[model samples]
Target: MTPHSVTLDLGGRTALVTGAASGIGRACALRLAAAGAKVRAVDRDAEGLAALERAAPDAVETVRLDLTDLAAAEQAAAGVDVLVNNAGLQVVRPLEEFPPDAFRLVLTVMLEAPFRLIRGALPHMYGQEWGRVVNISSVHGLRASAYKAAYVAAKHGLEGLSKVTALEGAAHGVTSNCVSPAYVRTPLVERQIADQARLHGIPEERVVTDVMLTDSAVKRMVEPEEVAEAVAYLCAPQSSVITGSSLPLDGGWTAH
Candidate 1:
């Protein structure tokens, strides 16, 4: 299909997006809703989830839960046709300085929770003979950088999980793929900038260029909608044949 042929006809589908209160998750929730999917927007922030429900009352259902709770994550995935694993945290510290506790926290949230959610949701999708799993991995998953060991490791593990899920689910018509993006202007990225500057003793300006956009040929932060567009494509009907892949919305960051 041509780029223009991509359209959302998810009227009968049910989508569950974690971390839907803001940034890429929020954008994905809204895009899925606009495309006619009944979206369950999950986030730990009750106020933000409420705001999303208010903004798209007709299109979304709000679920406020901390995904770190394995049971809660599993419950959240139950009965969903599409699972967008977009909830994650970042910790930018040199491996030598990285706290064990902090590393575990990042891994649990980014990798462990998604793995549980996918496993929990699989039976539902398998029974129906259709499903989609969109993991919001990062460009760092493919490459590497200094002072981001935990985040990079979790993302890389997520890609592997996506591949395994794709291979197993392929026969059942449940496609699994990941969208790897460069830095996007999200609250998460904004926080990363401040944290990196303080950790590395560099100017905030340098953080954006020397770190976030260092490898991007486009030299600009990606937009949430740009990433959401890719998610929509993966969730679409035509993407049935597209599985076990990492689609880059990286502004050519990985092209080099």
Candidate 2:
């Protein structure tokens, strides 16, 4: 894909970004704030949230939230003009060995929480006739892989939820879409490298080139900032006509 810079003016928007403490979420929170939005950064990491607050005290406010608390997750989204469901977790294990509890937790935080957040934000968005919902899905949402049943399942569910939200919200000027990316340079992917290495019986270095990037034509990991830019673009007026779509930052993984 050709690279292009996005210019946006969100002077009066209030944006809520979950998993805002680090990685893609951090980049997104800062990017939106730079565009003049009042951002509420939510995450379960207190120290990370504090660090994020210090980085942009005037533009960002931090909220420590564990999405497993479904009620609170919904309550936290109230009155926001933008909602980014970017918080998620993963476990690598064969289905037979996978813990049932882990599967439920993954679905709860990644899928159910997003539903509640949308539910909470919808009323306000409908009232104003404008809102943006960006779900951070993964390439796994479209394609399955070994040892990632739960993560893949949750992402697939998120994709469906996003599409449904788009269909229903279009009439109200509230758009919902997903940013599905391949492996990103994040703490989560870093952790996955080791797990993948062990599971595939390869060295950590080989996991990147042989396992992770095996299908990626670019042969490199995507940057968190790149994913954040896509999120920002979806919120731009230029993207008002785009909804119920999945934009893949897969470096040709999906192209194949």
Candidate 3:
């Protein structure tokens, strides 16, 4: 909503952004492209990808494929200078009632997919001696909420994966980090609003104020652009020394 002040020049770099068709992914795609990177926008949503490419001034190449196809997901990241793993889905249910298939898919997409993508990306990065791996995580990554067993588990695993990537990539000039944000105004979070309300036995209207913002000192959902800005900053030249770190965009939730 506010003006973007920071400037980044990634003119010659090739950036691959997963889930690039919407929300924070869309914003990150646009931001990186604006910084002059040859961005390969990956998403399963063809319609959304088309809209994104049409709206851009330059050509934004899009890969339309589901990340659950692990081999394809890995292949999609080949030869990119920057990788942003942002594709994820959430299933809200108590652990006892959670569907086993849903949990497996969640872990497959969020955790395993990132692993394969990193596996696909590292050789190229190590060969070139430069790369950036930015994972879009959430405050739930650092904390926890009830009735989100699968989502929380996957994020926690992702946090670990990101750190390990950072350690292994350090000597190779490949820095891996996570941008952990609180609730953002995105489709994923929007879908959960009602679920949260029902689980907590609160009216839908109260979900946003009382539940979502309970630990958030700011009491407002984060804008996708704000999260994108952090992503941009992490990939910038100045952030060379910052790696294996969890950058919190939590609206003060983690400050507790």
Best by lDDT: 2
lDDT of 1 at 226: 87
| Residue 101, model 1, lDDT | 98
Each model's lDDT comes to 0.92, 0.95, 0.92
Residue pairs whose backbone atoms clash in candidate 3:
none
Candidate 1 on 14-59: residue-level lDDT in tens? 9999999999999999999988999999899998898899889999
Cα lDDT tens digits for candidate 2, 49-150:
999999999999999999999999999999999999999898999999999999999999999999999999999999999999999999998888899999
Residue 154 in model 2: shift from native, Å?
0.4
Off by over 4 Å in 1: 1-5
Off by over 4 Å in 2: 1-4
RMSD of 2: 1.9
Which of 1 and 2 is the better model by lDDT?
2
Question: What RMSD, rounded to one decimal, does every model reach?
Answer: 2.0, 1.9, 1.4
Candidate 3 at residue 21, lDDT?
A: 93
How many pairs of residues collide in each model? 0, 0, 0
Q: Which rank order by TM-score, best down to worst? A: 2, 3, 1
Model 2: lDDT of residue 140: 91
Off by over 4 Å in 3: none
Error of 2 at 213 (Å): 0.5
